[model samples]
Target: MLLITGITGHTGGYFLKELINNKYEGAIRCIVRNTSNTSSIDNSRLNIEKVVGDLDDPEFINRIMVGVHTVMHIYNIHHSPMIVQAAIENKINRAILVHTTGIYSKFKYASEGYKIIEGKISELIKNPKCPTSITILRPTMIYGDLCDRNMSKFIKMVDKLRIMPVINGGRSLIQPVNARDLGVALFTVLMSQKETTGKVYDLSGEKPIKMIDVFKIITKELNLKTIYISVPLSIGVSLARILKILTLGKIDSIERVQRMGEDRSYSHNNATIDFGYNPMSFEKGIKIEVQEYLKKNRN
Candidate 1:
């Protein structure tokens, strides 16, 4: 049996589809919160058991780990310690844990916590007593459908604004992976335990594109008359900070705006070699995203 978590989330939906489309012949159990819409995991075609519980509860995770040989945890990386503990206790064969490349962020407050949590995970892997083979896959900014808030927010903003501000002239490089591509990497790693176990894979996009180019591509795809207004990095951050304060923290992420000037690209060559990980280009990806976004959001 395979136990999965976050199967109802953005990338989770894509991951579930991969398993079903490939006709994975195994008893599957998915851990989810009580309120999660299980429409993606609880359909008639798939025979997946939807086990509702809190992954934060070690007891809950431990209980479900039983009889489950392989575990695919697609949820919060912060909850990984307990999941790792549960996997060790149950003597699981292979555990696939999904993380983000955001761990490399230059943002002070966020990076500190991410590094600390990652440190704990690192300690688990190095510990001699632990036996479960764990593979950590770090995907860059994930965007495919509307469920992806990162790109979706920008898409919505483009629709609302006459002129979109290009921070630092969108010069800093970024490589974002599509949700389906990340899911495929996870499934491939899960199936190929020998090569991927005890390794960290940086699953980025097909190539890195300048941040300015991203908005330009969006404008092209949407066929909108949204003009570009260049905003200096410092000016952009200050405006974001001021808006956040005036909005009582509702317009948060001043740091996100600041970090827009910092490059956030990484190499996925190892992931490509190991599992034939082929990710779609951002140009092609944004085309699909615009279609999905327009269906629900456009007038």
Candidate 2:
């Protein structure tokens, strides 16, 4: 049996669909919270099952791990240790975790949290007491459809304002991977679990582009006239900090602004060498996402 966490999320949803379309022979189980809307994934497949519960609950973890062999954790990285503990207890052999490249960011808080989780996972994987093999994939900014919280927001902003702000001339480099491509990469890793165990790979787009260029590509795709205003990084960070305080952290803060100003590009060569992880170009990915966003909003 195969166990999947966060099956209803963007990347997870794509992973689930790919699995089903490939006619996976094993039974699939999904753990979801009570408030999670499964309407989109409420399929009639006999092999698919949904269990409602919080990941924080030990009882829930115990119940969900029964008869499950391989686990794909696509949700919160914070809950990974708990999941690994439960998987070890249940004698599950292999596990894959979806993490982010933000762990390597210059921002202290962002890097610290991911670093803690990554360290915990590494420690557990190395422990002889736990024999479950682990594979960790750290992907760069993921953007696709309306569900994405990253570039989709920028697309909407450009569509509305027709003018966007560029911090430090938006020179900071970013390699945004498509969610579907990420799903494929995860599947590839799962199929080659033995070779990928106890390894970490950085997944990214085909190439890195300047932040300002990303905005220009979006505007060009939409055939919209948008002007970019270059703002000093220091001033932008200060304004974001003030807004963050005023909005009670609802808006971008100092750390977020700092991360935006730092380069986030990474080479996916290791992933490719390990599992043939070839992702599409950002231009093509953004074009597909923009089309989806337009179609979704048109309804």
The lDDT leader among the candidates is: 2
- Of candidate 2, the 10-residue stretch with the lowest lDDT total is 39-48
Model 2 regions lying over 4 Å from their true place: 44-46, 248-252
lDDT of each: 0.86, 0.87
Q: Show model 1 residue runs off by greater than 4 Å.
A: none
Clashes of 2: 0
**True-structure RMSD for candidate 2:** 1.6
- Measured with C-alpha atoms, the lDDT of residue 287 in candidate 1 is 91
Clashing pairs in 2: none
